[model samples]
Target: MNAPDASDDPTPLALPRVPRLRVACAMQSDTGCVRQHNEDAVGCMIPRDDDPLALAGALAVVADGMGGHAAGEVASHIALRSMLHVYYASAGPPPQALAAALVAANDAICERAGADPACKGMGTTCSVVAIVDDRAYVAHVGDSRIYLLRGTAFRQLTQDDSVVARMVRDGLLTEAEARRHPERHVLVRVLGTKEFRPAVAPRGMPLQHGDLLVLCTDGITDQIDDATLASVVRSHAPVDACTKLVELAREAGGADNATVAICSLQAEPLAAQPDPSIRTTRETRAH
Candidate 1:
């Protein structure tokens, strides 16, 4: 005779919780055959299972340093270290946090360069990819790049901030001509510069199971063509993909410091325990 209580409903308790997305990542960096010192830096920040902040889902970056001597190495190391530190310490969404992190890194590098006469003109190209849930956010400066590979198709996600890239975009030069251009390696925008402005992706890229994300310095791109790069990625596992890519670049004369980070996304399945109290019946079907 009494009205049923809404709080007593059992339907809400029967609903299942959503599973978290899982990502497998691998990174490889080499000084290459020509460079006396490795000026490239690669790193990733994978959140622990019990992390409280949760904002730092997964972040990966690759930085290619310039300005000869040990200055290049120091610039790149500073870029990566500062970016990671600021990213984890800051609050808000992944995209905003990543952008702020890059800015902080640029400022840190600039301050360091200005403080030391030997590193005055030092700069570095940086490309970062941050994934949260089923989406990926990107932040980049200079010629380093972030690429996405899904199934049989591959695409570059970030535009190069290099003179040759700008020329090609303006129709002043063809892709082939740009590749062979004398100033192809000359960067128009890079970190550690007074006028540095990071290019952040307007929106996160929707990720699907089996999606592959590649973050690398121009060293890899300089040695490997897009088609060949795609083939090598598709043919190898995540770890092997990184190793093979670096190896391929080195085999191609290794003109610069080669560095690569590969991340593969997969959907995690929820775990359900069997209830011994539930009675079940098995019935065989006829063929």
Candidate 2:
């Protein structure tokens, strides 16, 4: 909520001649100091150099679960898995395809919650970013956020769909007060609701070498300010930036589960080949 007015363009100033760019990515998640279980989930799909979707981009998603205990975890897990699966296989453009994926995930989550009584009202906040060629495409619902950092300019790419956020925008509340407000976590538009609609970025944001795209749950933003976040990312690599950001959130009282994913655009030759599914994080822990 501390970012510049959402009215400003999120696309950074592009270089004169953007080259064949590639993404370097990493993710980290934790239960935090006060939480007994991690309800947050993080995932991504970085395609092979030869894959058709490779130019369309690599996808990264972060979801913050909200129903309580296992129900919340289930909602987030379902959202992550469903989105990634639906996204890669769809043939639509990045913006349209990403929007459809979120809608599908919302339906999937709703269906799961209804079938299981314990998960009756379970829901989650989902934020996704796709870096394709030299452009970044995004779609999200709820308060989980996507941020773009280009050079010294750091901007938030998504808006919070919550009561406190509305008040702040309407000039009824200040950012400082909104952060501490009791209803800050009471989001108005989250996954698992029939009315949930993903807000898709109007167009792909132009990118440049050294540009950094970040996706994270509220835990990280709640505890640290934007200046701090920009500094951590600017000083570290993608993997280390995620680790350091999560650690800082934990140190800052760790009120909820913290999760972070980073995608850095580097001007370099394409790699030979690669493969990784989005659900690896959750499934790995099951072992």
Candidate 3:
């Protein structure tokens, strides 16, 4: 809840770029400071910008599923697959597609749970960001989060939809107090609920060179403090940043499944710009 300060960002480091807009992501799930099986799941796709048949760049998500009897894993996978399908099949801005995909995924999870008695009450927290035409549209539910780093500053975009979060919003609990609350783990919204209506609105933002967007589950944020998290991201490569983040979470006694997806949009190469001959595929006007 503290505004990012110099102490927040990890010491700056050198990170190279790939030919196209490089989105280097890495994820690790530890049974964690303690646990029998990992319940977290992550998915990524870098769709072709020109190919009409490609599903790349349409959607990338990180889901932290929760349920008893191994139902968490099932929910995560189902959400990912269904979201990807809807995202690609539908057309429009990345935000609209992302919202549609999330709603569809939520329906799919609900349907599956309805059919299987054992998987009853299964649910998953989904946080997704879709990139199109050098912009990102974010949709999230539950405590999973989306963060951004621009220049030397860091900021978190999505608000958590959890019991503790609701308390904070209502002014009944301070952020620091919520961190230590016994019921902090309680979630308010997640996929698979019969009354599931996720916060699937598309929140579009301009993409800047060297901008970094991170979508992660509660596991990572719950353990590592925001200042430390931002520092690690600023100090290492995307892959290494993710590794370090997981390590930090473990160091802080990771009590849940930890996952992180690092996406950095470097400046497009001069030669990579679209040609005038092809029609521009504008998703939305610049903000």
Candidate 4:
């Protein structure tokens, strides 16, 4: 697709004037104490010199694919690449850029699936965190999640859109039971399927100094509770924290493909504003 026309906003569209925020990312899809090949993919993109705003705010993403052979991996790469292309080309308001990216990704994935018979039924779960200025913009589908850590307080920022998540929401099942459900991994929506359009939420509120944000697949969340996960995130460095978190899941029986991406925020050198994602993680308990 062609890039969007440039415009003047005065505010840094090409780059955020803040000191560059650096990130450390890693993905170890170990087929998890089982299986022959891994199907999880995770990535992080920092805005280049041409797009300094992205550097000010970073983009971290995780995708979990499901299908026979290596089809899942292909599905995830296409989705992530499509999103990066759209977001960089358009250079619009943060929320608008994120929304457009998601749509473009969905289309690109579906197109790929249609062209390849081996990947006929392939699909993937996608969750992303875009840190721009002091804010974090999040767009997700399926069960992958984004979490925030502030001091000793840690919380999940995105909601799960899977069958089990919905069931838990409707009070049809308890949180504990949902965890043990035979079909807990069943996702209601994902990328690279026929006629799919995920409901896009707005860019999340901005982050405060000393805040930490994480993105990961169900492989990690399934085996650990929020409190334990939070404890680790608040204590370790972003890279080490993820390593320990994944280790915890393995100890609890890592039953599926796993991936994680982390970003920590400190004081910015440029002008800053209030960020919404900084608020505590919201909860919705069913009756």
Candidate 5:
């Protein structure tokens, strides 16, 4: 036998790298039974290949407007549009970008409210989610909410900036009592105000495969409880879940416009390969 050669030594092959998670989103909005016109707005923007400032992920936003007639709709629309635009247009990390976008949105809404008499004093509740890589950054104002469903457990990621919520936090009222309180709809912090500040998630939440993010105006939560909401999301696909939730809200006597956006993170699919066992044949025959 030949002597063993150093160059022929066996080496282990490196393991394949795992692919990044891709997000699937679904959204719906409805004018509830009581509301004559929908004052809620929902928007989402996924990064494109050609965009240099892209976060390599997606952004979802929900805004609930608080003014009568078309004013409320305009405020919510402006806030949603401005926030999404600023987030994609600015170049920075997710948290900073989200903050800047919210501030810019607030200024834009305020300016519009000041300029137009019909929209004066118009304001809206906003909840935004910036999903980048394996993390999610959340920012919000007023009563709209963001919830996270990881595995079987569900958690509220944002707090309501309403009087009832404040009372509950201060121990003056129980959660149930606050929910049924007469002033539950009074918001303390809302966009379009001269002085407004948003509460941003201090640290990003680590996202996992099968993680479900629920963004919605209070209209949905007002009708369906958290447990029921989570159950619906887990039982159906993203689009179907949104549709079911909105329908449920309407069935529960939706007193306000309902809007919901669902986003699910999933592992990228493996590439497909051609099957050698199957062969194709082309024949030319005289007619």
Candidate 6:
């Protein structure tokens, strides 16, 4: 018999199913009760099922911009948009790509500032979270933060790069003191400042099922304390939690732009896990 003609069959080949790191996310940003322009920008990329980065990870960012007029808005937009572009386009581990993305964001902002005189002194505080399997990689600068709520304990994972924060770190100021300090808003490190030295965090932080990650600007934090924030998240889904947080902030007489993003990790069964990943030794988690 003659070989079957290949053109006889018109059925499309089925694509293999891909296992994914399950995550549910929600975010909200508002100009708040005072600011006329919303300078804060947020972005995230959940890799497509067929894309290689799907297994490598997903990324989220919150940037609080600083400048006069519309400069801050431009800076934040550029930082967020550039980071998303560079992150999904890069290679290597998710942690390494997260670091590279920050650099690209900084460079893009710097170039924009140089091109526009009105945006000369613009800068932004950037905080990012990259989730890969049971690990989370964080890249942060300025005073924005990433908080983790696992079980009954909730704490900040990203340290603020601000004057008061540094003081608190050095023991010159207590946590409460820093929170109420006169210079709490003075940030020492920020993107678009031309002084950024992006530190690459090795590997990723270990995460567990039922873990919730919150990334936000000071607007949300300055209004709501950690305990209250955690309570809202615990009582509601990510979508409702985000809106509730924003409402709470505005209710507290928020005076600046407020932005918040949350991601919840669902249970991962043992059978679905891939081969064990190597944990980093002597690895430092830098913001």
The TM-score measured for candidate 5 stands at 0.87
Candidate 6 off by > 4 Å:
1-20, 268-287
Clashing pairs in 6: none
Which stretch of 10 consecutive residues in model 6 shows the poorest summed lDDT?
12-21
Which sections of candidate 2 miss by over 4 Å? 1-18, 269-287
TM-score for each prediction? Answer: 0.89, 0.86, 0.84, 0.81, 0.87, 0.85
Each prediction's RMSD to truth: 8.1, 13.0, 12.5, 12.7, 7.6, 11.1
- The weakest ten consecutive residues by lDDT in model 3 span 13-22
Query: In lDDT terms, how accurate is model 2?
Result: 0.88
Error of 3 at 115 (Å): 1.6
The models' CA-based lDDT, in order, is 0.87, 0.88, 0.80, 0.76, 0.88, 0.87
lDDT of 5: 0.88
Cα lDDT of model 4 by residue, 84-152, tens digit? 777767667767777787788878777777888888888888898777766778888888998888888
Higher-TM-score candidate among 1 and 5? 1
Superposed model 5: Cα runs more than 4 Å off? 1-16, 269-287
lDDT, candidate 2, residue 15? 36
Which candidate model has the greater lDDT, 2 or 6? 2
In Å, residue 91's CA in model 1 sits off its true spot by: 0.8
- lDDT per residue (tens digit) for residues 12-117 in model 2: 5543433577787899999999999899999989998878778667999999998976999999999999889888878988998898899899999999999999
Residue 20, model 6: lDDT of 34
Instruction: Point to the candidate with the largest TM-score.
Output: 1
lDDT of 6 by residue, 161-195 (tens): 99999998899998888888989999999999776
Question: How high is the lDDT of residue 142 in model 4?
Answer: 81
